[model samples]
Target: MVVDDDPEIVNLVHIYLTNDGYNVIPVYNGNEALSVISHHRVDLVILDIMMPDIDGMEVCRKIRKDNVVPIIMLSAKTEDMDKIQGLMTGADDYMIKPFNPMELLARMKSLLRRFHLFTQQDGDNSSHKDDVVQINDLKINKDYHEVTYRDSLIDLTAKEFDILYLLANHPGKVYSAEDIFNLVWNEPNPSNNTVMAHISNLREKMERAAGYKMIKTVWGVGYKIDQ
Candidate 1:
C-alpha cells in the first residue's frame, strides 16, 4: 500500500510499482489506510508522516499493536531525530522526501523479502519441524507467527518476534548487539543504538505482563535469556 496526502506522490509511486508488476493500493489518508488494513492483507506499506489525521507515526503504533506489516515512513522532515522517532514508533524503514523511485523500489523489495516467509519446496514430502517454541509461559508458534506470554497475546512486530525467538531458542546464549544486527538485519549496522532501541522496546512490551525481567542485559557484554 502507498499512502500520501499528496496525490502526485501517491500516483507516482503507484505508477512505478504497478509497472514493476506489483499490485498497488494507493491511499490518500491514514484513516482509510487503517480501514483497508483491517479488511485486507497488506504485505507492506509506504506511509507519509505529515497526514492531516492520525499521521504515520500514530498509524504505525496502532498497527504494531496487532499487525506486523512492514512499514516505510516518508517525510520531508530531514532531522536525524525525526528518523529515530519513526524507527522507535515501529517503522521498518524511513526515507526522506524527493527520494528516487528506484531506491524506494529496492528498499521495498528488501523489506518484503525480510517480512515474508519462504515458501516450502514443491514435491518435497518431508515433514515440517515442530513449529512451537515454548519457554516458561512464553509460547512462540513459528507456524502461526504468534507469541503469547502467560496465555496473553503479545503483539510483536516482525523484527521483535525474530529477536525474541532467537534468544528464546538459545537460552543462556549471549549475543552482542553487533551480532544481532548482522544476524537479524542481514547487514552490518554502524550504530549499536539501533539494536539497543529495539531491545528496549522488546523489554517494555514483554516485561509488562511478565512481572519479571525476560531479556537480561549483560552490560559491556550483550543480552540473553536465562535457561
Candidate 2:
C-alpha cells in the first residue's frame, strides 16, 4: 500500500512497483489509506508523512496496534527529529523526498524478503499460546499476546510486542538496535531511528504497566530488559 498526497509521486511509484511485479495499492490521503488497510491485507506500506487528515505518524501508530506490517515513511522534511519522530511512531524505515523510485523498490523487496524468511523460520511454532513470562512484576503471555505490569495490561502495537518479546526472551542479553531491526523487522539494514522510536515506545508502555522502568538503556549501545 502507498499513501501520498502527490499524484505524480504516487503514479511514479506505482509504475515502478508494477514493473517490479508487485500489486500496488495507492491512496491519496491518510484516511483513505487507513480505510483500505482495514479492509485488505498488505505486506508493506509506503507512506508519505505529509498528508491531509491524520498524517502518516498517526496512521503508522494505528497500523502498529495490531499489525506488524512493515512501513516505510516518505517525507519532504529531512530534519533529524522528523525522521526520529516517524520511526518512534512505528515506521520501519524513512526516505526523504526526491528519492529514486528504484531505491524504494529495492527497499520494499528487501523488507519483504526478510519478512518471508523470518516467518518461514518461525514456521508452525509461531502460534501464540498462554505461557506467561514473568520478570519481577512485568508479565508477558505469549499465547494471549498480552503484556502486563503490576497487574495492568499494557497496550502495545505489534512491532512493540515483537521487540519486547525478543528482549525479554533473552533478558540479560543486550541487543543492538541493528540486531533488533534485522531480527524483528526482517530488514537487512534498518534505519537507526526506526529502532530508537520503537524502543522508546516500548519503554513508555513498560513503564506504564510496571510502574517502573524495566528496559534499561545501554549508553552508546541498544537496550536490554533488565532481569
Candidate 3:
C-alpha cells in the first residue's frame, strides 16, 4: 500500500516497486489505504504523514490496533518528536520528505524480511516436534503454513495462523495477549489491542467455518482452547 495525497509520489513508488517484481497497490489517501487493507492482503504500507482525511499517524494507530503489518511513515515534519511518535504509533520505520527511492526500497525489503521471519519463527522453534497440530476438528499444519477445519481449508494470514497454532498446540493452557504477541511477533508490545484484534478476527473465521468458536477467551486472564 502506497498512501499519499500526491499522485506523483505514489506513481514513483509504484513504478519502483513494480520494477522490482513486486505487486504494488497505489492508494491515493489514508481512507483508501484502510479500505484496501480490509479487503485485500497487503504486505507493507508506505504512508504519507499529511492528508485531508485520516493522516498517516492516525492510520498507523488504527492499523496497530489490529495488524502487525510493516509500516513506513513518510513525513516532511523533520522533527525528532515526529519520528518518535510515528514509531510509537506502530510504524515500523520512518522516512523524511524527499527520501531516496533506493533507500526506501532497501528499508522496505528489510522490514518485509524481518516481518516474515518473526511471523514464522514459532514453527521453526518447534521443528524437532511434529509441526502439524490437530485439536478436535481443527488442524494446523505449520510445515505447509496451512489450516483446515473439519477437513475444509481455512484461509489465514501468516500472523493469524501463528496465533492459532500457538493456542491450539497447547489445549487448555491460557495465554495472555502480551504473551501471544511476544511469542508470535517476537516483540514485546504489551497492553495494545493488536493481539485482541487478531484473536477476534481468527475467532470469527473459526466460527463461520466450523459453526462454533474454537478459541476460548478467558475474561481478565487471556485466551485458550478447551481440551
Candidate 4:
C-alpha cells in the first residue's frame, strides 16, 4: 500500500514496486489508507508523512496499535527530527522525497523480506527446538513471535521485536546502529537516525514494561543489553 497526497509519487512508487512483482495499493490520503488497511490484509505500507485528514504519523501510530505490518514513511522534510518522528511513530523505514526509485525499492524489499522471515518462523518449527530468550523480566518467544516484560505482554512491531531479540541473544555486546541495520534489515548502509528512532521506541516500551531501563545506549558507540 502506498499513501500519499501526491498522485505523481503514488504512480511512481506503484510502477517501480509493481515492476518488482509486488501487488500495489495506492491511496491519496491517510483516511483512505486506513480504510483499505482495515478491510484488507496489506503486506506493507509506503506512507507520506504529510497528508490531508489524519496525517501519516497518526495513521502509523494507529496501525501500530493493532498491526505489526511494516511501514516506510516518505516525506519532503530532510530534518532528522522529522525522520525520527516517523520512526518513533512505528515506521520501519524512512525515505525522503526525491528519493532514488532504486533505493526505495531496496528498502521495500528488505522490509518485506524481514517481515516474511518472522511470519515463516511463526509457522515453521521443523527444528523442534524451544526458541526463547530472557533478559531480566523480559521474555521473547521466537517461535511464537511473542514478547513479554515483567509477565506483562508488550506489543512490539515486528522489527522492534527482532531488534530486541538480537540484542538479548547476545547480551552485553554493543551493536552499532549500522551493525543492527545490517543484521535486522539485511541492509549495510542504513541511516543512523532510523536506528536511533527504533532504539528509542524499544527503550520506551521495554522500560515501561520492566519499570527500569533494559537496553543501554553506549555513548559514541551503540546499544546493548548488559549482562
TM-score of each: 0.86, 0.75, 0.57, 0.90
Candidate 3, superposed: residue stretches over 4 Å from native: 121-227
Candidate 4 lDDT for residue 178: 93
Q: Write the per-residue lDDT of candidate 3 for residues 1-227, one digit (tens) a residue.
A: 99999999999999999999899999888889889998999999999999999999899878866676888889999877777667656566678999999989997887687557535645355572477788878888766666888889886645567788889889999999889978776654353466765677678778899898788888999999986
Tell me which of candidates 1 and 3 scores higher on lDDT. 1
Which numbered prediction scores highest in lDDT against the true structure?
4
Candidate 2 lDDT over residue span 14-131, tens digit each: 9999987889998999889888989999989999988888889899888877776878999999898999898788776789998999888887777676555434433344453324
Deviating ranges (above 4 Å) for candidate 1: 118-129
Count of residue pairs whose backbone atoms collide, per candidate: 0, 3, 0, 0
1 against 4, candidate with superior TM-score: 4
Pairs of residues at least 3 apart in sequence or in different chains that clash in candidate 2? 88-197, 129-143, 130-143
lDDT for residue 102 in candidate 3, whole number 0-100: 90
lDDT of 1: 0.83
All-Cα superposition RMSD per candidate: 2.7, 4.0, 8.0, 2.0
Q: In model 3, which range of ten residues has the least summed lDDT?
A: 117-126
TM-score of candidate 3 versus the correct structure, residues matched by position: 0.57
